[model samples]
Target: MGMMKRLTAALAVATVLGGGLVAANAQEVVLRSADTHPDGYPTVEAVKFMSDVLKKETDGRISIQVFDSHQLGEEKETIEQTKFGVIDLNRVNFAPMNGIVPATIVPCMPYIFTSKENMRSVMDGPIGEDILKAFEPAGYVGLAVYDSGARSFYNSKHPIKTLEDLKGLKFRVIQSDLFVDMVNALGANATPMAYGEVYSGLQTGLIDGAENNWPSYESSKHFEVAKYYSLDQHSQCPEVLMMSKVSWDKLSPEDQTAVRDAAKQSVTKMRELWDAQEEKSRKIVEAAGVEINEVDPAPFVKAMDPIYEKYADTPELKDLVKRIRDTQK
Candidate 1:
């Protein structure tokens, strides 16, 4: 927050238009945003769009600089830094955030959302507001939730057509206890590895495969080695736009409104970009010769029952699941 105050004098620029500065003199406040995906990935694109929106919405008084492709550090480390006020902003999956804010894990549960519409209803309404508030106690200010699409499994060994097909396969997962539990519940060896290490792990047979959205499978070029992508559609883990509480507290009320509004507006744009990217990435991977398969989610859902029960370790999480399932568009 102190950082932004020092720049207020330097940015006496005008209205922002056509990606250019126009009229009036305003204080310039530049904040940093971070993402692990490459430049074009939907989450990163959303961050860039949010930066633009922030500049324009605030009349060039505020701007954001984004770091993509893990330029600063891995997800967990940067997440902690954001908590401590070292990092101003972070775009990360809700899966890892469950530990710091339990309400986040409710929507991230496997098979939780019936459709994107259903998800939007939950994330943009009361439930979303509740979770965002829940984040306040954890040293984070939840700005918005971005679509992550669905995470399906792809492997070098074989196609996952059924629950039995998943057994004995080594799959890379985020270093989250919930994900580890979910993978193990499916009878697979959950290999928790860093995102950058996944390719080599798959190539060297250290891991048989991994689960992720279409863009990731194509962008990371994992499809080249792991030729079989199973559409288990296990979870729609949304990405969270988080600002450090320290930074949030530092902002003037007007600046806070600008940043928060910009973040929320970016969600609509991000989803549009995400849908197109998912389709494009899927087609690209298929043309690259990756065999994409679909599975009846019933068995997979049934298999996840225990994990769901395990997840209801607290009253808040239990109520969260019920509310999300009950939410309607």
Candidate 2:
């Protein structure tokens, strides 16, 4: 009888241990993502979509928690954090990465992309793949790219019908030398500032104007302060989704593929959201009585020639620039 009791106890203990092992194997992983845009912004929503895709693809074992509205940090700060693995994922404009990642410089060049479709074609093709590969050496795994509609200048001062209208206006630019030079070349005072500070800068008269997409202008409510928006469509730089190499290296090979696939699928969702948001934001700003104008892009394009020469200093950048321009859109 005692021998029978010992066998039963051993069986019960083995069952409990087996259950614990299964539970350990099924542990959930939630990656933390950061974005400077506010919650429900197209990019933020897209990341949420990515999370859904990841969760479903991984059978609920993997997911993402996004912190938007500078919750983690601004673009520049988040870039560094993501590199160090303090942030698992990041969505940032190409401008901040230009100085650190040479591949990004050409893409951020003024007038480099002729239109949204042109930009999308170049980035969705081989050229874009090359740029994504470049991120690895910079401690990031390039996940996907999203649209940042054509950026144009808007000011609290007056209409910018000509280059003359932009002169002497203190404009807020991302913390990038290219942006500074671009604004200065157009004869405006370029004040390099964080994205979060632009609204307050406009309201307090600290900056005479700033430049961005319609969605940004409306979402940030900058349209209320800077009523004059000129559609020169200066830069069509795309936003990038990135994963920290530190976090990526910790994932299994299968999970890595799942994450990459999920991010890629999220791009389609992002573009759809982006198109609708752009139109919605445009209507919202127009309804708010913001004076919008369309300036001849000839002078604006001409002013960027020197800028192009200055940034495409290396053979690689020049080659990339030529290929992008020559690419059939």
Candidate 3:
């Protein structure tokens, strides 16, 4: 009878050990993330933060690998790959995705945001949530929004101090209807082009000017050719961190929670990096012999009023603009 009891006890111990081994094997997960920006940019910093947190939180069971500097592909291409489940995550500008998700274009409208603080408030609240929800149909899960900074004009021709100064200038703009329309309304010819082509376009004088935030302007060395830096702050364009719905839905509940938590933390870090870089960018461009001018934005604001009115008439987009304006402080 004692011999029989020993056999039973050994069987129970083996069962427990097997179950523990199965649980350990189930915890491992790997995810991939992509971005178009070069290393050392704010977006990369944020992605790195996410990668570090996910690994630490899951005790090495979850890991994220980031592809930077367009190593995977351009923003739009990367986002499309994410949708098709080829890539797990990407940081993309809202412009290209606007076609798939219409409301994404609203924030790119000129003069929509009065200040950086106002932009942050609206994006962190209901308006931001609504925009994020619009991504579901496109097979993307919008995780967080990172600052792209306020876009302004840069040209090699001449300084754009007044509305008339922009007349007939061929300015390269991203492929967005709102951006194209806004540039047209200001009396400049808007030539839609890819971000990678802008530097060479300016160098060859194929395009007389382009518009972007200070960090981009300085980092891409557009200031080298475009000696005129006009701080019109026309649009506050924020970059979005998104994940493939396929990959997101595949995560265990615990892993999903961890990913969300890491995303939130990364956004806070990205904003701090962006703010510091914007200030540093301004000094760098000024020292590079790039003429930095703070012009009156009233003219640009007045020019885009009609664009706002048109969007306001649309049922879905109307309330968001009102909410943003009301929340402005």
Candidate 4:
């Protein structure tokens, strides 16, 4: 009888342990992550960082499945899907988000940030927080910002060494009034088009030039078609990683903490990657026969001053710009 009682106790303990293991396994959550960049880009690296950290920190309770090269869809479609709760997360350029949250356009205005450090200070500080807050009403929870280096001009026709050089050139631009106005102020015909079509458009001579960072110009091989890369560095539009409000609301407080912590880590890592990648990209483009010109930015800055004036009527935007200019150190 004593032997039988001991066997029964051991069986009960084993059953409880097995049940606990099963319960823990059942708590797993799978998330979907989407971005427009191709697999080998630095943007994809940042997404992977978030995925790896989240899985490890959650002890495998959560995992992110990443979609690169716009496998899910374009920026607009991805954002719409996120808003409708069909997707969990997406990394978007601020230009597209401006459509959903108009206030986001404020940051993309020409010359809003005079230097990379100034831009970093604004985005990593309270001003960026305020911009993030503007997205909540549109069903997004902004997590972190990824650097999309400063925007500059590239053309097949001529090197834009001065504002006059840009005159009458057809320049491709994103569908943002801020971009349009800035390009217009420089005397170029701003042609708004989707990014995927830029290479072909430039190749076929449908457009004379476009503006983007060094990495994008190199990676997309736009340097092959457009020979001149003028470093105007007119605007610094950082991409944002955002979560679906529907998905975020479902997370327990502990899981929310894990996600936020992972996002912060990814942002810091991305900045380091961006700085390194920008240098690498410049070398690559130069090797590919792209002539890089470092023009005096003062003329460009002076030409874009009207953009600031256009927004000056609004106290919030004016004050925000003042604060950013003051915060430079």
Candidate 5:
């Protein structure tokens, strides 16, 4: 538990000193959740839906107040805030978490997940449960994993039909060494930048392009500047909903169960919204004259061999990668 979390729990208990244990259990608690994505985004809306479930489950005693669109901070900044209990909950991609959590690196690797369906299957099973458990020792209680669809390369320059087209091109990537290495391996120069900064980076020519799912490219309005979108579909890393251990410790066991259950149930809503959002964004971008192309994934997959070898060196990671590969598609 973090110092802030401990202090928060202590303060809550102190306020009802004379009321006994029942009063503490009955105390109304509202947790603060953070998301970089704007309102109506699937991840944001899903958390909102979870809040509704939690309120119903707890008889309105427990609720969540979401702060979306970087209202709190960017992903990297909010992650630290969540850890220290400055933020109660967070929804973040696995890339930003790679350096801090080893298990997250496995899923963030390029070409590791064959398709969205496969990725979801792997993450919703025992393997996913194991990965979720990995968060606890690192200061989070992972609740559920949500879909990010498939990520493809999009740029302001020409369509990347072949590996040769990407050579020497500069691209913005999330703040992760694996992401940097992955971009560099594909024959491009990787510029580490925040998600919020990518739009300006693209418009100002600070970067040639970036990689992300269709919805993100559309929602962030990056598609307006980056006209070429190549469907390499390189990565299918999932998004995670996590609670600060400090905030978690403050909840009674029953309330904790309610939170977990509600979070799990929210995945259904997220996936439905995500599927619809992907289709809608694709249509909008296509209508806007964004050149979208499908590339031969064979060459891209071949390029990732060295990346896999470098990152999945440990026996634990090797086993995890193998299990994910062996999972039924």
Candidate 6:
């Protein structure tokens, strides 16, 4: 009878508290995320950190399950899955996001950012926020951007000491028109190929060279066959973390805040991991006897003038590029 009386009293107190009523149990939410990179990649690590932070901030009410290495699907497939609400979150390259959110092209444009510091400054500021916000109309919410490092030219045949050396060399490039055009503008024959086939392509002498960041070159073991690495640092293609609008809308207001805050915190964690990974990869590649070279980027910059003229896709895009170029770190 005393227990019954206490239960009744507690019910009466809860009714009086109205919307402020406390419940003994809360709903649990599980979010599914996907990353194309392998485990231990900086982007994968960032997602893992985000998962931990979300669980902590939401008091275990929310948990994220991350699928890496195309376990769910390739980047483009996973993007569509996120949009359809099948995947709650995604880690993908920003270049493809331009197809859904055209404003992202500003960041994907070749040689736009003067350096990584310059790029991060723009990305971590209002401009980056604006770009992320642009995803809303496409049924996506951008959570954060991550480092992909600037891509540089590397090859097995010869060293690219000057602009002339780039001519007549067949190079493998990402299957993007911008990258293809950039390679052609640089006086090389651009052969579009899938990333997985690059090693065989280099090994079999199908292609003479490729362009990518240090971590990719080293991690992919492209440096083993391709001994010459020229640090032209041509493009700074960033990675993006995104959530489906459908999934986001399902989150409670408080949970929404928690997710956004967790994403913000994860960005800081990724920057550190990415920088350290790049340095470590560079050291490993150099110690492996990769002949690294630094070339004057002026000629390479001039080579892309035509590409810029062609890529100024809109007044908005042109203005965004101008803002990025004018931004000083």
- The lDDT of each candidate is 0.83, 0.86, 0.81, 0.81, 0.87, 0.84
lDDT for each residue of candidate 6 in 1-329, tens digit (9 for 90 to 100): 34344334434543553211122346667677889888888888888898899888877778777879887667777777678676788999998887789888878887788889899999999889999899999999998888889999999988898899999999999999999999999999999999999999999999999999988898899998899999888899888899989888877788888998898889988989989989999999999998988888888888888898887768999898888877853
What is candidate 2's lDDT per residue for 1-329, written digit by digit as tens? Answer: 24344334433543564411122355887787889888888899999999999889878998888989986556777787677666789999887888778998888889888789889988989999999999999999998989889999999989999989988899999877888999999999999998889999999999999999988899889998999999988988888999989889888999999999999999999999999989999999999999988888888889988998898999999999999988844
TM-scores, all models, native as reference: 0.84, 0.84, 0.85, 0.85, 0.85, 0.89
TM-score of 4: 0.85
Candidate 4 all-Cα RMSD: 11.5
Off by over 4 Å in 4: 1-25, 194-206, 309-313
Query: Which candidate comes out best when scored by lDDT?
Result: 5
lDDT of 5 by residue, 67-174 (tens): 899876667777877787767899999878877789988998889877788888889999999999999999999999998889899999899999999998999987
Candidate that beats the other on TM-score, 5 or 6, i.e. the better one: 6
Deviation in angstroms for 188 in model 2?
2.9
Predicted candidate 1 versus true structure: per-residue lDDT over 33-65, tens digit per residue: 778888887788887888899888877778888
Q: Write the per-residue lDDT of candidate 3 for residues 47-101, one digit (tens) a residue.
A: 8988889889988887777778877666656665677566778898877776788
Runs of candidate 5 exceeding 4 Å displacement: 1-25, 193-207
* lDDT of model 1 at position 321: 83
Tens digits of per-residue lDDT, candidate 4, 1-329, equal 24344334433543564411122356887677778888867778887888799989988888777789986666777787677555678899888886687667767777777788888878889988888878899999998878889989999998888888999899999877777888998888999999889999999999999999888888888999999998878889778999889888878999998997898789878888899999999999888888888888778878877877884447776776677777764
| Worst window of 10 by summed lDDT in candidate 2 | 17-26
Model 4 misses residue 117 by how many Å? 2.5
Of the two candidates 3 and 4, the one with more favorable lDDT, higher being better, is 3
TM-score result, candidate 1: 0.84
Score candidate 1 by lDDT: 0.83
Per candidate, the number of residue pairs that clash is 2, 0, 0, 0, 0, 0
Candidate 5 at residue 157, lDDT?
A: 88
Q: Ten consecutive residues with minimal summed lDDT in candidate 4?
A: 17-26
